[model samples]
Structure formats: structure tokens, C-alpha cells
Target: MRTRPIGPYGTAVSVIGQGTWQLERADRRTAVRALNTGIDAGMTHIDTAESYGGGAVEQLVGEAVRHRRHEVFLASKVRAANASAHGTVAACDRSLRRVGTDHLDLYLLHWPGGHPLEETLAGLRALHRAGKILHYGVSNFHDRHLAELFARTGPDEIVCDQVLHHLGDCSAELRVAPACLARGIAVVGYSPFGLGSFPPSPRAAAVLDSVARTHGATRHQIALAFLVREPHSFAIPKTATPSRAEENAAAAEITLSDEDIARIAAVCPVPADDGTPSSASGRRP
Candidate 1:
């Protein structure tokens, strides 16, 4: 797996990571095999959340990596409802327990809910001080949310943001990614396949098929390769099938040329190659 430093703070993760959403909701054996296979294929950064199957997926991740934890960069998240200082602490504690790890490589707030950011960050800092988490970030946050955060804390306090970014959605790139890149924070794209909920349009499908055929890979691999091409961007695609997990890991090896990236971007609505979004300052890292 190709690795990059996720943030200035020094967390190097695989450019193509593993997302374990609902990984253990059905057959426990299959879920464990997928996790293990992905890791074996050099999928080092594994992400999960408290709301993923009521924490069952975290347990599955724990079991899958119990013997090889050092080989993986583990990330987990707490729901927005638990954004309070005490709630955040308690939730992270449970996550650590479920994941069978004393400390998380990265911890995140699942979203910006009604809770006060100060209280939430205080709890996250508490975890950091106690060595329960190395870095803290957020998910599903836009530019305004990032503004609010930078207003209170230094820009570097948050290490990354995880968002739904795929062939059909470039919302994060338009609103969140430039802000993150400016501050030297990484952006991790989850649901690269749209959580199995979104299907590509015919035109987008054709674009992906064309790129995939050129690379001798599946369309899904082409879709994921687009995300990792962006500077300071990573992708974590989740699947409970072992074969699919292996395939997802292989996507990291398919390098798309500038033309392939631009063709996909034209169909996906991401900013033009001239710049990431609005200004020349948003250039890819």
C-alpha cells in the first residue's frame, strides 16, 4: 500500500484504507475474513464508528487485528449525540474497549450536532492527554463547521475530516476539502462506492468503464482511484466480502493519468484541474 502523512502531526496511512461499516451485521465469520484479508493485502488504515451496527463492527475489527494491531492504523468515531465532554469520554472509552486497543490512532466526532463544540473538543483533548487517542477530527462537516472550529482552536488541532465522496458526489470537495487542505489537514473519503446506496449515471459509468478498461481493472477500482489522486486525500471503501475487500485494496495500485482524472471530474462535478475550487490557493498538495 502507498502511504502518506495524514496530517502535519505525523500519521502515515495507506492511501486506500478500509471502512468497516456493518462489517459484522450478518455472518460473523465472513466479516472477520474480509477484515483480515484487507489487512493482509496492505490495507492499513481501518475506520469504524460507534453507530456501525451498534458497535458490533468495532468488535469484529478488534478480533481481526488483535494479533497484528501494529500493522494497521485504527480510526473510530462517536455519534454527534455523544459530543459532550463526559459523553465523548465515555463513548471513546467504550470504543477503545470494543476495538481492543488502549489508544486509537485517530478519533472523530461523527458530525456537528446540537452540542457545543467547546465541550466536545474538551473531551477529545482529554482523551489525547490521557493517550487514549493520538489525533481528533470530524466527519460530515462543511466549510462553516470548519470555520467555527478554527475560530476556537488553532487550525492544526483537527487532523482530518471524513466525508462521503464518490463518483456521484463531490460535495466535500466543493465545500470542505479546500478548507482542510489550506490548514494542512487531510481529507479522508468514505463510502467511495456510495455505501452501496448510490448508483452511477450511465455517462459516469461509461467514463469509469473507459478508465477501468485502460487500466485493466473494474469500474469500482477506477472510481476509487480518482479519489486518491487528489492531494491530501484518501479513500476508505467498505465491504463485508473478502474478495471485494481484496479488490478494493488493489485499487491503490491503479494510477490514473491527468486525463483520466479530468474526464471523471467533468462528470462528477469536482472543481476543474485549473485549481481545486475557487482560487489558485486551493491547488492540490
Candidate 2:
């Protein structure tokens, strides 16, 4: 898998990262196998959250990668309600203990909430000062929130912003994408396959089918290819099956033509409002 520089942390992550959302529910053997498969496939990044399985997922990830921690970039998030400095500091320590790591490559605020943004950012800054986290970012933030964060915290302090982005969900394109592009902050796209809702339209499916036929790839590979094709973009798709994990990692090599990209973009309409799905409501994982 090809790797990209995430930010000032100098951590190089795979283009296709693994998302550990439902990993805790999988039997320990299955979880270990899937994670090991991902790592062997050159997937150097693993995204998990403290809220996932109420901390079980982090524990599982910690165990799976303990021996190979240097080969992977580990990232996690603190819950939205726990945005305060105290809460964030405590959460960071808990994540470290669960992951069996001394420091996280990247730490994120899972979601924006009622807490003062400055206070939340200050908490992350404190963690950075203490050498608990290498970099800090946000998830599920809109353009306004990003701007607020940039203004108060300054541009260099924020590393990246993660959001739900797929062929079917282009809400980030309106403001978030452009803003990030201009500011030099990488955009981490989660659920790049539209959460399994692929083939954006009949037209898109037709185009991808032809492309896949020529490249000997699956439709899912074509979908993920569309995401990484974007500059400074990274994708993390969750999967428990080893085969699916391999397929997702293979997407890194499936390059698309300009015509194919245009055709897919045409069928997948960019939403006037933010493309975040209404069903996206859930705890971070």
C-alpha cells in the first residue's frame, strides 16, 4: 500500500487504513486475524476510538499490534461530550492504557458539542505538551467549526479533520473540502464505500463495471480508488472479513482515468448542504 504524510508528526500512513468500529464484537481470534491481515497487506494505519465497544476495541487493537507498533500509525478519538480539558486529558490516558501504547500518533475530538471550542483545543494542547499525543484534530466538523478551530487555535495546530465521505456522500465538498485544501490540512474520509451502499447510480455502476473489467478489480475497489485519487485525502473502511480487508488494501493500486472519475462524479451528486448522512448519528468507533 502507498503511504502519505499525515501532518507535522512525520507519520506516514497507508492510503487504505482500517477502521475498527465493530471489531470488539468479533471473537478474539477473528479480530486478531483480520487486523494481522490488514497489517500484512501494507495497511499501516489503524483508527479506533475509546467509545468503540466501550474501550474493548482499543484493547483488542493494542494486543494485535503490540509487537509491530512501530510499523503502524495508531489513532483514536475522545467522545464529543468529553471535550473539556480535564475530560480529554483523562480520556487520552485511558486510550493509552487500553492501546498499550505510550503515545498516540494522532488524537481527535470525536465530535463538536456545547463545550467551548477553545477549552477543548486547549485540552489537546496540554496533552501535546505532556507528550501524550503527537498531533490533534477533529471529526464530524463542518466548515464553520473548522474555521473557528483554525482562528482560535491557529492553522498549524490542527492536523486533520475526519468526516463521513463517499461517492454517495459529498457534503464535505461544498466548504469543508475546499477549506481543507486551501489550509493544507489533510482530509481523512471515513466510510469511503458509502457504508456498503455502492454503485452511486446506474450510470456510475456501468462506468465502474467497465473499468473493473479492464483492471480485473471489483466495484468496491473502484469506489475506494475514487476517494484516494483526491489530493491529500485518505480513507478508512471497516471490515471484519479478511478477504474484504485485502480487497480494500488493493484499492490503493486501482488508478482511475479522468473520464472515469468525471463519470462517477457526475452520477454522485455533490450535496448543496453538507453531505453528512442523517443516519450517521452514532458513537465514535
Candidate 3:
């Protein structure tokens, strides 16, 4: 339930945010229950996108947070195909309508393609200037893309980069992490539990199990704790169950020792030729 500052924007988001990609397929009651459970557990950050379930997720979020919008740091992304200035502007308006919000705490470029980097940056800048979005970020970007985007837009405008980072996927450590760290950009790590490929490696599992026993937490909780323990790092693990939501929120209080961190890092997967881990293939988006 603790919060972490998301980049230099001074916005403090929940350490364990809720990703709403899977909520699109859930029925109304189920979706509302899951969202309410997350809020009740002190999870104040939620990530969604306009493309998710053709805007169904955003609509559900709107309904769930009708009277509690101020309690959560809501975030959503614009698809790569809608990367132009015009596209982004219109998309942001549409997102606000769907979510029943006037503004977003963070708005991200869902992918790193489909338009010129400058165009995308310009769109984000316009949104910030218009007060439609508080901060701007990117997802699914590589080192080269990060460099190009930052170079064109300057570092201050780029707040964070959401990427796949977990025990089974630590490829971001090679370049993305260092680049963001040096530039003062926060890293939002998605799929912190490897998207259901839990209990990563024997070494990692052993370390996690030991830490869990010490904290009376679950393996998944220990796994998430490992990510948020890093400076300027955040984790968003999706879940539809109330029990799992509470378990994830409890991880914020589970601090890992230096030895535990080193052990977990040692077993993290290495990057492949594409600069992404092999385990990332298991991720749906």
C-alpha cells in the first residue's frame, strides 16, 4: 500500500499498481469486485489502455471509481497506431470520457512504433501543456528507441518507461535500467511475477521462499518485493482475485536483504539477441 515517486513529476503511485488488461473479459460484477478489492487493499495506482477490450476496461474503471477517483493514480496508454499528435490528442479525450475523468496521472505511448518519435513526443507534450495528462511515458521500448525519444523530447518530458521485468526477465538491467537511472527516469516493471510463470529458478525460488518465510508472505509477494526494493522502480502485477490483490499489496512492506537481492539477480534470465529476455515471449503484450 506504500507509494513510490514516479519519476520527477512528483506523483507518488502505489508500489504495487493494478494492471487492468485482463479485466476486460470479466463480467460487470466481477470486474467491479476486483477493482474495489484493489482499492480497498490500498492499491492507488491503476494502468489501462484504450485498446484494451475496445475501451471496456476504461469504462469499468470509470464505474468502479465513480466516487473514489481522487483515491487512485489512474494511468492509461495510447496505442502505437495512434502515435501522431492528432491521434494522441483525440485519444486522450476519448480516454478521459471512457474513464469519466478529466485528466490522467500518467499517459504512456503503448509501443515504440507506428509513427515518428518526434511526432509521438510532440503529442505527449501537447497533452501535458493542455493539462490532459500529468506525466508522459513509454512502454515496450529498447535502448535505441529510448535514446532517440529522449534526445528529441529532452529527458524531463519523459517521466518513465514501462517494461517487462521479473525474475525470469531481467534483460532491462543490461541497458534500459542504467539509462533510466542515469537520466532520472523511473522504471515501471510489468509482469513482476513473470505473467504466471512463477517460482522462476531454483536459486530465485529458494531466496524468495526464505524471504517469504521470514515475512510470512507468499512467493509472488516476495517476487514483487524484489522489484520495488530498487530505487526508482515500480511494479504492476495484474490480478482479478481479492485475495491475490491483498497479497500483492502486502509485498510493499516486505523488504529484501542485500543477500536476497543478489541471489535473485544471479538467477534472472539473460538478454537474448533482441535485447529482451527469452521469457518475455510468454507475455501477451
Which is the leading candidate under lDDT? 1
Clashes by residue pair, model 2 = 171-275
Q: Which residue window of length 10 is worst by lDDT in model 2? A: 276-285
Clashing pairs in 3: none
lDDT of 3 at 219: 84
Q: lDDT per residue, candidate 3, 116-200, as tens digits? A: 9788878898999999998889887777788777778665777888898888877777788888888888888887877667777
Instruction: Estimate every model's Cα lDDT from 0 to 1.
Output: 0.84, 0.83, 0.82
Model 2, span 1-285: residue lDDT tens: 888877545567798899888788788888778888999999878999988999999999999899999888889999977878788999999999999999998999998874888788888999999999888898888766876777887657777888888887877766787787777777898877775567767787887788788789998898888888876789998888888889989999887898878877777767666455332322344
Go through the candidates in order and give the C-alpha RMSD of each one to the true structure: 4.9, 2.5, 2.4
Q: Residues 234-260, candidate 1, lDDT per residue (tens digit)?
A: 999888889998899999998999899
lDDT agreement of model 2 with the native = 0.83
Q: Which one wins by lDDT: 1 or 2?
A: 1
What range of 10 consecutive residues in model 3 has the weakest lDDT sum?
Answer: 275-284
How far residue 145's Cα lies from its native spot in candidate 3, in Å, is 0.4
